[model samples]
Target: MTRTIRLRFFASVREAVGIAQEELALPDEVRTVGQVRSLLVARGGVWADALAEGRALRMAYNQQMTGADTPVGEGGEVAFFPPVTGG
Candidate 1:
């Protein structure tokens, strides 16, 4: 089944992805924050480069800082941002 989640991007991630937030419907295989990220990454191009695994990306689920493995479901929220930001 497919489900939807709110996606929030911050700092460099926002700059790179060129969006602050969005609502994305996910496939059944995408049940975790990591998988959500992977879904975006699969978009290729900037989505892949901006969210590349080689980068130090931080993830959150429902506003609580979490690892990519954190589970996500319909109407849940996920956030992505860099580890550090400039003043």
Candidate 2:
């Protein structure tokens, strides 16, 4: 069976998309966090721009900050958020 990954969106992204999270089937070719974002982009326009490569994005895997190449095991949780600015 294919592995599934959970993606959580936060802050503006969540509000814009109107969803906090989603479960996605991991494609064999999408091996990195960046790739995963690109995959979501292909879903359509909103997804594409929201997950655009050049945008300011922060990522976590299993609740920890992770790089694009971080390996995601089965049923892992990946989160995306805009850069936090606070005092």
Candidate 3:
């Protein structure tokens, strides 16, 4: 079954995606945060470049810091952003 999830982009990720937030319907195979990112990376272009593997990026699930292995349920929220630095 397909599930709907909210995506939030911040910092460079927001700039690359050109949007702050969006809702997407995910396929059954896309049940994890990593899979969700893979789906976006499959889009190619800036998406692949921005969220590419080996890049230092951070992910959060439902406002809590987590890894890509985290399960994403229906109506869940996932956020992507670069590592923050304090000046």
Q: Best candidate per lDDT, number?
A: 3
Error of 2 at 1 (Å): 3.7
Q: How many residue pairs clash in each candidate?
A: 0, 0, 0
Q: Give the Cα-based TM-score of candidate 3 against the true structure.
A: 0.96
Q: Which clashing pairs does model 3 show?
A: none
C-alpha displacement of 37 in model 1, angstroms? 0.9
Model 2: per-residue lDDT, tens digit, 1-87? Answer: 588999999998888677999999997887778778778879877787787888898989999998888877788998989999999
Q: What's model 1's overall lDDT?
A: 0.92
Tens-digit lDDT string for candidate 1 (1-87): 779899999988999989999999888888889888888999999999999888899999999999988999889999999897669
Q: How far out, in Å, is residue 43 in model 2?
A: 1.4
lDDT of 3 at 49: 91
Question: How far out, in Å, is residue 70 in model 2?
Answer: 1.0
Best by TM-score: 3
* TM-score of candidate 1 relative to the true fold: 0.92
Lowest lDDT sum, 10 consecutive residues, model 1, at: 77-86
Sorting all predicted structures by lDDT, with the top scorer first, yields: 3, 1, 2
Worst 10 residues of 3 by lDDT: 27-36
| Candidate 2 Cα deviation (angstroms), residue 8 | 0.5
